[model samples]
Target chain A: EADIYQTPRYLVIGTGKKITLECSQTMGHDKMYWYQQDPGMELHLIHYSYGVNSTEKGDLSSESTVSRIRTEHFPLTLESARPSHTSQYLCASSDSWMLSVPQYFGPGTRLLVL
Target chain B: AQKVTQAQTEISVVEKEDVTLDCVYETRDTTYYLFWYKQPPSGELVFLIRRNSFDEQNEISGRYSWNFQKSTSSFNFTITASQVVDSAVYFCALSGTGNQFYFGTGTSLTVIP
Candidate 1:
């Protein structure tokens, strides 16, 4: 089945530690996005990629960065984690289309920084 | 700026009761896309419905229905004879001239048996 996947569903790390959240999709989508969401809160876009070797920051400023070295993978890395980074990170992908496009989401990774 | 607003934060209803979740959006673009997604306790979002700005026709799938009104910039979802399994957070989103989806603050629904 075509689906999106995320690794390290749950993580606990000390502040200032380096971490990378992995996201992959088998749907052959060209556009991928990363969003930050708190428990019982709204989703805020942090980063996105158009395709291989194409990445851009999202509406909400984030300390983390993302890379799209391959079309099937988009990983997000934080240089130094902080308590404010404690939240669920969601990955999504959408096929190329101008109108009426629907994005599919993956199981989120919940990170806790202490 | 594109924005989506889901007014009801949380709603609780009996298993057999009918419930409606309201969604309002704001966008300057003449054409846009709207979507509804359901997120269970497991925390993965599942797509429910998608409608374009030109298609004002209402959609019905199983016991779920969506009302999209371009004049009022509203897209509402209704679940008929709600079930315990229907308990989850529902979000409404808007896509304007790009790949990004402006999501609303989700509406948490609890269906009690």
Candidate 2:
């Protein structure tokens, strides 16, 4: 089954702790994105990658950073977590072309900074 | 700037009833794409349907149907004979030529037994 996966489905950490959210897709998609969302709120894009060694910050300014070392992996890291960073982080990937090319999302990792 | 608007914050319907979710979009580009996704309580986003700017052809998948109207920049989804399993949050999204997407706040639907 080709699908996107995120690790640590739920996380609670101290405010100053450093954490990394893992995302991997076996679908071999070239475009991958990271979005932050609160419960029942609109998704806000935080980072994206076109391919390996290519990454870009999204419209919403975020303190976290992402890396695309491999096509199947795009991980986001926060050097110092804060309470404001508590939210659900979703990972998505899609092919470049198609009639719609709707993104396929992962199950998401819910983070709580205490 | 591309934007998507879903005016209905929440809706409730009885099982076997029909319901419609409205989506409106704004974009400067002539060509763009629209999409609908369902998020259940488990928090997984499921892709439902997609429509492009040039094609206004309505589509039906089982009891689910979509209406796309380019004139009004609207894309609406309707579920006929709804069931309890249809309860979820539906989101409408738009993406321009740049490949960046904008999404609506979403509409929450609840189906009563």
Give every collision pair in model 1.
none
Residue A39 accuracy (lDDT) in model 2: 86
> lDDT of all the models against the reference?
0.94, 0.93
User: Which candidate has the top score in TM-score?
Assistant: 1
Worst 10-residue lDDT window for candidate 1 chain A reads A94-103
Q: TM-score, chain A, per candidate?
A: 0.96, 0.95
- Residues B1-113 of candidate 1 have per-residue lDDT tens digits of 89999999999999999999999999999889999999999999999899999999999999999999988999999999999999999999998877579999999999999
Native-to-model Cα distance after best TM-score fit, residue A29 in candidate 1, in Å:
0.9
Query: For model 2, what share of native contacts is present?
Result: 0.70
Runs off by more than 4 Å, candidate 2: A97-99
Per residue, candidate 1 scores C-alpha lDDT tens digits across A4-102 of 999989999999999999999998999999999998889999999999999999989999999999999999999999999999999999888666778
**DockQ scores for all predicted structures:** 0.78, 0.68
